[model samples]
Target: MWHLAKAPDLADMEVMAHEMFALLPEGFRKLCEGLIIRVDDFPTDEVLEELQAETEFDLLGLFQGVGLPFQSGEVSGQMPNMIWLYRRPILDYWAEHDETLGHIVRHVLVHEIGHHFGLSDDDMEAIEAQVTDEAAEMPLGAPARSG
Candidate 1:
């Protein structure tokens, strides 16, 4: 199969991320209005330094911008919330793991979205569970990647 020949690139991963986000519950999606999703092959040098990552693969995804609970009307020049998906790290993870790429993408998206809401780990787990249950009802398919 052509899939065996190459890994999905940044654009391909972006499509997968957006599709997965669309599959999330409407309430959650509404809460995330104006959120942006972007995919890159690796994190920037600045990000690596900031996160103190030992390796580029140390992070699979990241959430940037202020969380809802921390926002203040007095604050100015705030940026929109964003979720970043790293394609190379995610692909490397997929190579080592048994789960489908769709599942991995969905999990990362949910985790990052949780950050936007400033949800605790337990709450995040509960949200993830809801996604898993919902996904079981209708499986999501990963988009095909083009070289």
Candidate 2:
């Protein structure tokens, strides 16, 4: 049977995601509540079926379930909002792109968590711009990288 090589453990991904999140402005993390971050090597066949993916390499991250805005009255127990980062896909992206691994991880984290809060690409861009502006306000000699 064909199988993939070893990947980063779940704990490591969680820690990596959190570290990237912390680097964002304080308010950004607060906006996403009960959003669970999960990491897996590639999307499962079930996910491919659900997402109508034609190939395994088609996805890097996925946000499962609905966002908060759509909820109405009388909501009972339900699954928490979740973002899945496909490890192999991310590693593939890393290899394909010239960006640093930390930046790629941060990009994945931001986009996936961005979905949890119902943020659009434009919205994410604005947030990114704001973070960039804030970082520029730091000490003159020392500069903070966007990663």
Best model per TM-score = 1
Count of steric clashes across candidates, in order: 0, 0
Q: What is the C-alpha lDDT of each candidate?
A: 0.78, 0.68
lDDT of 1 by residue, 19-118 (tens): 7787677777787878999999888999999999999998899999877787777566778889999999999999999887878888898888886687
Give the per-residue lDDT digits (tens) of candidate 2, residues 1-147: 228634446566555655555567667766666777777878999999998998888888888866667756556777877878877777788789886555666677778768666889987766655544344233223433433
The local lDDT score (0 to 100) that residue 13 gets in candidate 1 is 75
Clashing pairs in 2: none
Pairs of residues at least 3 apart in sequence or in different chains that clash in candidate 1: none
Model 2 alpha-carbon drift over 4 Å, by segment: 1-10, 130-147
The residue ranges of model 1 lying beyond 4 angstroms of the native Cα positions read: 2-5, 74-76, 132-147
